[model samples]
Target: MSPHAPVLLNEVLEALAPQAGDVIIDATFGAGGYTRAILKTGATVIALDRDPTVQPHADAVANDYPQTFRLIRTPFSGLAEAFAQSGEAKLDGVVFDIGVSSMQLDQAERGFSFMRDGPLDMRMSDEGVTAADIVNAWDHGPMAHIFKLYGDERQSGRVATAILRRRVERPFERTLDLAEVVEKALGGRRGAPIHPATRVFQALRIAVNDELGELRAGLEAAEATLAPGGRLAVVTFHSLEDRIVKAFLTERTGNAPGGSRHAPTAVETRKPSFTLTFKGAREAGEAETVGNPRARSAKLRAAVRTDAAPWGRIAA
Candidate 1:
């Protein structure tokens, strides 16, 4: 078997506990791996993905499961709206696999890889502003801010300075071009395990996609759509996303840390909308880590939806 297996597969199965006839949502149905597993448990799956390139996988699942599977061509952030559009009031389970998919990264044309040369496009839906647009057109200050905040790159200002200087000569139109410029700006990787352009690419991808914002919306959407006892499983590939998931689950599950003596607390608080499924996040097993290197960074945090009214909408 290939080591490119799905991350935290068995753990997700354990968390969701999908049963026959249950309606589950594979909120980020990248390769449809999780959806397929859900289908095997006799659960009906509503799989969503913004990337049209994933249509073939969707077609295959729909073909195999026919009446038991549905594919929605939309971002996972729209989970609640899609379910409402389907005339369904509640969901039994919802799983979100956050960050770029293997399908996207494996292809160079998507411009998600720093290792390969490709067009500088990184729009998952192919319908929005691209990474090329940002790198080539964005100002130095904004670009630096994005790299620092979103990518966690320490030398963000320096990189931005380099990008601005280079783009003045010729705007970056290729993935490798921008990567090389960044590498040069950072003074080369030397012996670093990863490429110097990794963080910059990640920041650009996140900014272009508004990933962190979308994650917040998706979490609330899941809260609104799930029925009592419904399961919500989120698998994040990086610290930024994992932090958001952890906080959301914590507050919704009524486990937020209490205020200290110096910080007084408010009198009113909304009832918890979920119950913690476990104490904390779950990591990939050693076997999984070896089988799928991508699983090494994967962290799963799940909760069971409570009967309490869902949280009100917030800015995405």
Candidate 2:
């Protein structure tokens, strides 16, 4: 497996500004990268991850930190419940590093990388629907929708048609086979630098994992759990993820566009739950990106919680 490195580490650390007595959450806890850094600052950390593969990593962090750290094997979307169950009333900071890790991508058996052949299992939690399950069973229309919406693939129709026709004869049980089918569907790469199956694989993974939905729920949970003046720093790897983060912060912070055409009820008007910590999203510095290519597309967006009630907490 490839060694994991947390993208935008400096940016995240700076945004959280951990203090000795502060309590923080490493919301994704993949490889315990951010948790390790936060622990270095003498803060207590409650880390969460849905992947059982990271349990050993979390155990190592707990061993290192002893009383100052704890790990919960759960999705970050369960942030509110996790905090409640931990008996921690509020949090000083929550840091979310969204998407797959280098460890997951490098391990062929995990099937996250199309570059290597493995079983067609792309599950982060090792639960829910697998990529093979979707590809082998989903109807062509819904399959095409996943490709077009999540992967932004223009050849979704052709690809979906190909997959349906091919799977009828023999279900795609391996990453390389599905990739080959996609490549053929798209006319064998046509000299594109990216693999022909890149987008298709991404779409399958996203659809199976319900990543966007998880993010939405997790953001809401963060709003509910953060203490007043607490920090939320999220690092997203793509435009879709970043757009959701930006919109969540924007609407929660009362900066949403005023709509005369479609205004929500006066009582349904949102109370500002957070304030932007910076002007807009920040990209990885040249030095960082040069060292870790994964940082190339990373974007960091942060906010400080206000005293106002969370969107769900407020009475309509």
TM-score of each: 0.95, 0.95
Screening candidate 1 with a backbone cut-off below 3 angstroms (N, C-alpha, C), the clashing residue pairs are: none
RMSD of 2: 2.5
After superposition on all CA atoms, what RMSD does each candidate show versus the true structure? 2.0, 2.5
In angstroms, how far off is 33's CA in candidate 2?
Answer: 1.5
Residue-by-residue lDDT tens digits, candidate 2, 100-130? 8889998899888899999999999978889
lDDT of each residue in 77-150, candidate 1, tens digit only? 78888888766655899999999987688799999988889999888987989998998888889999999998
TM-score of 1: 0.95
Candidate no. 2 TM-score: 0.95
lDDT of each prediction vs. the true structure? 0.88, 0.89
